[model samples]
Target: MAWWMSSSRSEKGRFLFFVLPSLICWHIWKARNKAYYEGVQMRLGRICHDILIDMKGVVEVQFNQRLGVQTFLQLYEGTAHPPPCYSVQLVGWRVTEEGTLTLNTDGCSKGNPGVSGGGGILRDSLGLPLFVFSTYFGETSSLRAEVLALATRLRLCM
Candidate 1:
């Protein structure tokens, strides 16, 4: 049987292992294209540096470690940002008759067509989270992910 067919590894681990080669190849291909098209030739040393920086950022975020929010912001701002937008935003708000207010905040991957994740939080009158969650969907087109997220959220709300 194929290694992937075995249940020895968790789904997440399997997914990571399965996609690792493709991800590496994708980066190499992209770097080559950048060198050829953008005239931004990067030596292997520079490429390794860039990859290290990227991996650090990913580890910080994944582990929910505050290595410093500013570091993340600087690394992700504008043109320096990676595949996903890192902006925080408000989604909805409501005022209750009991003199209370609520806010719904969400962060979405606008690049659904690309590999992305989506997350949201619903806060009560005190800004305390009633619920919060995030999901990652692998390689897809942005438009397709957008529509799918919308449809999924609508279903969740309903």
Candidate 2:
């Protein structure tokens, strides 16, 4: 929250930074309720889109009359949308004993029960890749995806 506020200091920008948290939390809470009580699947993309729509409206109504429609729209677009950030980390891999093989795997889900996948790699004692596999489980929990990845590797070993 502090980082977001510090990124922009314009009057409208400050307003957006202030109300952004409330708008985000409200939509997320509503989505959670809808998913639990209504048995609807929650989609983050849809929730974010809805939040953006509300933010746009709030900016327009509060500033448009005085700032003019075009200026308000520009401010809304610039301040409401945060800049994209990307990061990378280098991980060191450990080698197995000379007589053994090692396997590493991972799983991920976009929205818990939405769009799941797993992948793994097997390496010889020398740390040379021996086998690799990737698969899409399609709409499953992260735990299930992880289990599936390990199971697939076990089956390959057998």
Candidate 3:
């Protein structure tokens, strides 16, 4: 059996096998470049040590995306990583002119072409609620429900 296979079992061993060759090739190239340019050569043990140290940087970057070094490898130990956070900004609705009303409309569907519904609200200049309505569209696309909401808004105004 190979030395790596003797150290670990199954997928971990396979993953290490895939990654080690690339690191080995990279370090070998670096050693070759130094020898060509500066007459310096790395011994076999030194080359292997350099490769291991370089791999540390790659692994650290991936773990940094999670939490810290202590908790990063916790997936194999059965501890779940926390979900990432995102920032969102929301603005309030604007008021209409004193003589006019603002109508806001929206629509929703269970699926692209499944059961759908539409809703609308009419507000005055001070943003106080004036009128509201919601209707079922049986089975239709969200776009159809949106169009129906707008049509209902226009009919209500007249």
Q: Against the true structure, whose TM-score is highest? A: 2
Residue 19, candidate 1: C-alpha displacement in angstroms: 42
Model 3 C-alpha lDDT versus the unseen true structure: 0.69
CA shift of 67, model 2, Å: 21
C-alpha lDDT (0 to 100) for residue 81 of candidate 2: 49
Q: Give me the runs in candidate 1 sitting further than 4 Å from their true place.
A: 1-112
Superior by lDDT: candidate 1 or candidate 3: 3
Q: Supply candidate 1's per-residue lDDT for 153.
A: 57
| lDDT tens digits, residue span 1-158, model 1 | 23334455543335434554564576677789999999988577665555546544554565465444233234333212123437988855454555453433233454544676555565556566666656665677665555556655556555
* Best first by lDDT, ranked: 2, 3, 1
The pairs that clash in candidate 1 are 112-141, 112-142, 113-140, 113-141, 113-142
Which stretches of candidate 2 lie above 4 Å from their native place? 1-87
Backbone clash total for model 3 is 0
- Model 2 clash pairs are none
Q: lDDT (0-100) at residue 41 of candidate 2?
A: 92
